[model samples]
Target: MPPKLSPSGALRFETEEHTLCGLCRTPYKSCECKGLKDNLHDWYVWHGVPSTMIPSAKDRIFVGLPPPPDNSSRTKLVKRWVSLVNISMIMGHFDANHWFSTKWESLNASMDARTKLLNEMVADYVAQLPTNTELTVLARVLGLQRRAIAGKVDGIAKEAWAALRIFLSGDWACMSKAGSKLLMNAFNTRDPKKYPRDDPHLERILDSGVSRIYGVMEMGFDKKGYCLAMEPGRRPCGVGTSTTLETSDERLISKKARKRKTTKESIPTKKRRRVES
Candidate 1:
């Protein structure tokens, strides 16, 4: 059976021990983080998931991130297609490993502005897929970039460079027999800005996601237990929860404040007795 994503924050998921944590990702994407164990106290070590505080991939198909709990202040913004189009659109903060500085303000002010652009790109890619199965897209993504035993390819325009960048730098190797470094290298070099507008890699990952890219499906987060799910035999523990959201922001602020306060404190003058020697 598929997972149930509750809008009230009461949800249950079922997947085998070795399977993906089944959140914020497609078969083509990778979960580089850990998930919450059923216990809710200790972290889930095996198949982990990304943080829910940010957007997550949910709904058997598309929708940006997880839909908010019943009482979230951000409710007005739920289900917005652009919310999850970029994969890292979770929490509205651009993850550095994916997007560098200065791209934060690139969100479309109005949906109308992005509709045509996204549609054109997606239609192009969807037409070429021989089989719409998850494995097919995964195969393409892997073939387009790197292979575990064989290593990497030169360019990244074939994988969702325009519509999405699914494979996380750390997680892409989950399906490969080689080290994940190859995946990371391919992802890092796939910056859309680096490629020209004519590049064909920028296309939708799955044909089924058109409605999602167009804001038609439900979305949802949480399940840090994704690392091991990607690779059955790998040692994927301690894939800790993402503290990258507000907690991290607060810590950074507090650190700066402490530094300022310390500087403001007057330094006592050394006693003249030292000169008597």
Candidate 2:
């Protein structure tokens, strides 16, 4: 049966140290209902009760049946039991002597790290594009806000992932949700058909540690992964290199022109024509 709910005034804990909880029937210090009053909604929902309804103190749940209500007291002590349940879920138990626990915090930390890395990679990639083209790609293809292009790390990360997926599909002009979904399925199923083409640019991004792009690209591993704008064994063709090569070729051609000899027409050609006439 459910525990009796007393009027708010009679539920005070000051003179109730000896009085057991009406729900758990345990002393105040040892009561299992501690620290759950604030999370009443969570507790009720967890017990399969509608969020709009107030659950009974002794409601049954998948976790187990509730303790018999203490008829001698009239305080609603359901909160303490919910607190214990929440704590148990948080603190995973041991099987035999081995302790097993969830790494939710670590997973989040890793995701944050990847998000930061992807933001940097996107910045580098966008820098290589023409000024007008960069703006168009940021606005149209990736749907990035102006502030995102201005060093907003989280926004940059999101834009980079979208751009990378689009680029993998050979469509740098627009982002495609279909492409992104296929890429996600590739990662999940390890199917090459759903993966990106064997383009060098796409491969470079995939091999790098921008995991947020694919959620499996561990870029900062061992502190020696390739950046999005750079690739191994390939020198970047910058303006300086092109200018230097052009100047050297011009000099070589000028030297060859200077060395060429122009033979003048012989006057004997005219004499031979006169003799024949």
- For all candidates in order, the CA lDDT equals 0.26, 0.28
Each prediction's TM-score versus the true structure:
0.23, 0.16
Query: Which numbered prediction scores highest in TM-score against the true structure?
Result: 1
**What lDDT, from 0 to 1, does candidate 2 have?**
0.28
Candidate 1's TM-score: 0.23
RMSD of each: 21.3, 35.4
Total clashes for model 2? 6
Worst 10 residues of 2 by lDDT: 222-231
Off by over 4 Å in 1: 1-105, 131-277
Candidate 1, 121: how far from true, in Å? 1.2
Model 2 CA lDDT for position 38: 39
